[model samples]
Target: MAGSQGEGWRPARPAGWRRRMARLPLLMYRAGLGPLFGNRLLVLHHTGRVSGLDRTVVLEVVALDREVPAWTLASGFGPTADWYRNLKESPRTTIQVGSHRVPVTAHFLSAEEGGRIMARYAPRHPRVARRLCAFMGFEVDGSEDSFRRAGERIPFVRLVRSPAPGPAAG
Candidate 1:
């Protein structure tokens, strides 16, 4: 509801119940309920920047490239989100999509790329795109240009799967 009124709206970091609710997906994933969400959502396992402890966050998969084995995600809460920052410090991490855990390397996409991705995503998931843009303080008119502009303002990252380690030499 933060951006319901549109421009100049910036959502505050979630706290208390909201924070707990946001984290519920992580618990579900750990409980082996990940398949329920399918490939739409993924659990990102990362290291805390300051604490050096393991951390996990569930994020929606905005795009998926089976060929590259990559998943693109947007920072709904903006770049200040802990998970986003953590990836910056340590790009090497893992993600769980359904029952599969994949080793991946985070690659931040440029604004232009984000715009194109958003433009493509909007038509595929119109309602979600609208709501997501609104939640992120962007006013999208359902036009490709509007969605592209909104996407430009959002930070996106692509997690490309790392190749399996080769067998060790005897």
Candidate 2:
């Protein structure tokens, strides 16, 4: 599951925690368990916020926001999630699907966009979404304030496939 990394995007861990987790199987479980259990997990490679080292996180590919061409990570522990913060700091990132690794740039959605995405998610996974919303302190109201209170704490980003690097000249 290890692979080459490049610039952009932020790692979703908090310093010491990331290092400690690396030595345990929990990191693997958090990064791979869902994918291993019949889910499409997109592996994201991001740089550490402090160390500037690379860190990989596995997140489920829930839905593609057609209007923005961005993938929605809604209600996945709300908007305050770590990965969201990483993307907020640096949108450029790498997404690894199976053996295919592609470079992409991320855009953190505004309150309006995030609200719409959250609405779509609620219908699909009401129970989980509610749990996430509650934990993140968000109401079902589709307003910027609600999103700010709930999502600002979590991390969310919309990614676009980045152009491939040109062939190197000899």
Candidate 3:
């Protein structure tokens, strides 16, 4: 399940310095520097499935729908990523984008929907899309069809802002 793309497609877990570097963005978010990252990145706050403790992870925003106030994210490390798994176990969570925090509910997108998203994304961020696909061990030909196929192979989740809580009854 880890290597759906191919053997060695999934990246090994980072450790030591690499792990520290990966978590740097989280620190920035905590330090109120989230605005510096704009909307390109977001900090996800979720509860660990087994530990039942709060956890945080920074993920890239694959798509943003301001109208719905939703953000789409891809599990670059595949669905086995701890963050991705945690979300599956606890779909209710919160995300911080540019110093703005919003409660959200995770919604897993279907493969066909993911394909459409990838097709739309590639044209907008060709370089990032190509690099991301390569990093995920996908050989894309820089074609919409190729990107769509690659997107179908990966897991995508949309974090939609939860409705504001209504006033409590007396």
Residues forming the 10-long window of minimal summed lDDT in candidate 1: 161-170
* TM-score of candidate 3 on Cα atoms, chains taken together: 0.89
For 5-66, candidate 3 gives per-residue lDDT tens digits of 55545867789999999999989988889999998999888887888778888999999999
Off by over 4 Å in 2: 1-40, 65-69, 75-81, 139-155, 165-170
Of models 1 and 3, which has the larger TM-score? 3
lDDT of 2 by residue, 1-170 (tens): 00132223222443596657544433554555533523345667776565666676666555664454455454254344556666667667776655456677876667666655655555676675556665444454544345444444344566667775111100
Ranking by TM-score: 3, 1, 2
**Tens digits of per-residue lDDT for model 1, 1-170:** 22454444457778999999988998898899999999999988888889988887899999999998899999987888898998899888888899988888889999999999999999999999998887787877789998998899889999999875111100
* TM-score of predicted structure 1: 0.88
Q: Model 1, residue 9: displacement in angstroms?
A: 7.2
Per-model TM against the reference = 0.88, 0.59, 0.89
Error of 1 at 85 (Å): 0.9
Better of 2 and 3 by lDDT: 3
Model 1 backbone overlap count = 0
Clashing pairs in 1: none
* Candidate 1 accuracy as lDDT: 0.86
